[model samples]
Target: MTEALSSLAEAFKNVGVSRAYGTPVKVVGEELIPVALVSFGFGGGGNSEAEGADAAGLESVAGGGGGGFVLPLGVYCRNGSGHVAFRPNMIALIGTLVPLVCAVGFTARGILRTLRR
Candidate 1:
C-alpha cells in the first residue's frame, strides 16, 4: 500500500497537479492509480464585452481543431493489496502545447510582416 501510494503521488507530482486537493490515490487488485475530476471556472473580473469576444474567438478556433485531450485519473480499489499504475490523459498537454504553437505562429507572422515591409 505504501509503495502504491508513493507511485501514485509521484505520477501526480510529475504532472504539476499534485498540490491540487481531492486528488485520489488508490489501489485496486495490484494496481495503484490516481483519479481527478476537473471543472473549468470562468472568472467575472475581466471586462464582460472583452470576455465575450475572447470566448467567441476561442470557439471559432476550437471548431477548426480536434477537441482537446481531457485526462481524468480514476483509481479503483477493491480490497487492499494491488499494483501501481496510471493512465495519463493528455488534455492538459494539449492545452500547454496550444500556447506554444500560437507563440511560434505569431513570431513567424511578425517575421513575415517585417520582411514584407
Candidate 2:
C-alpha cells in the first residue's frame, strides 16, 4: 500500500508540474486506503519575471484552480450463508465537500471579476 501510494504521488509530481500534491494512504484493519482527502492545484505563469513584465507591462495575469477528493473507509464481509455486507465510515466527507465548495466559490468570484472588468 505504501509503495502504491508512493508511486501515485510520484506520478502526480512528475506530470502535475509545480502543483501536484498527495497524501499518504491510511490503513484500517486489513485494507490500505487513501487518505480520504487529496488535492490538486494548477496554474500557468511566465518563465521569467521579465517576460511577464514585457507582456503586461504591469502584473502578469495568472490563474489557479484547485480540487480535492475524498475516500471513505469501508468494510466487507461474507458469511457461510453467502451473504455480503458493507459498511461505510465517515471521516473525509466534510473534508471533501469543503474543498469542492471553495473551488466553486473561487470560480464564481473569477467570473464576477471578469464580468466587472
Candidate 3:
C-alpha cells in the first residue's frame, strides 16, 4: 500500500549512521557524545491458501521479523581546549581484543611448528 510505503520511507529517513551517535552531554568541562556500533536485520515471508482468504479477499499470509543490537564502543569528547578525542569503553575493548589476540596467537604457534618441522 502507498501508506505503508511512505511510512517505510520515513522510517529509513530517520534510521541511519547517525543513530549510532548519541546526543551530546556535558560532564565537567567537556562535551561528549556516547557512540556505539549499530546493526539491524529483517526477514519476511508469505504463503497464500484459498481457504484462508475466501471472505476477506486477501490471500497471502504475511509475516515479518527483525532484530538489532547496539554495542557501546566509545565516546567522542570535546574538551576545554576545543580538541576532540575518542575514549574507548574499556570492557568492550577487551572483549573485542581477546578473540583477536587468541587468533593471532594460534596462527603464530602454527607457523612456528611448521617451520620447526
Question: Which candidate comes out best when scored by TM-score?
Answer: 3
Worst 10 residues of 1 by lDDT: 59-68
Q: Residues 41-115, candidate 2, lDDT per residue (tens digit)?
A: 443344335555876776544433435543554444444454655444454556657889999999999999999
Native-to-model Cα distance after best TM-score fit, residue 5 in candidate 3, in Å: 7.3
Q: Which prediction has more favorable lDDT, 1 or 2?
A: 2
State the lDDT of candidate 3 residue by residue for 7-114, as single tens digits.
656776778778899999999999999999999866566668757596987966776666888889999999999999999999999998999999999999999999
**Model 3 per-residue lDDT at 70:** 86
Residue-level lDDT tens digits of model 1 in 1-117 = 345455555654544345222444443434334555543322112233454677576422211111223345444433453434444457755766799999999999999999999
TM-score of each: 0.32, 0.30, 0.69
**lDDT (C-alpha) at residue 65 in model 1:** 14
Measured on C-alpha atoms, candidate 3 has an lDDT of: 0.85
Tell me model 2's lDDT, rounded to 2 decimals: 0.50
Worst 10 residues of 2 by lDDT: 29-38
Model 1: residues >4 Å from true position, as ranges? 1-24, 27-30, 33-87
lDDT of every predicted structure (CA atoms): 0.49, 0.50, 0.85
Ranking of models by TM-score: 3, 1, 2
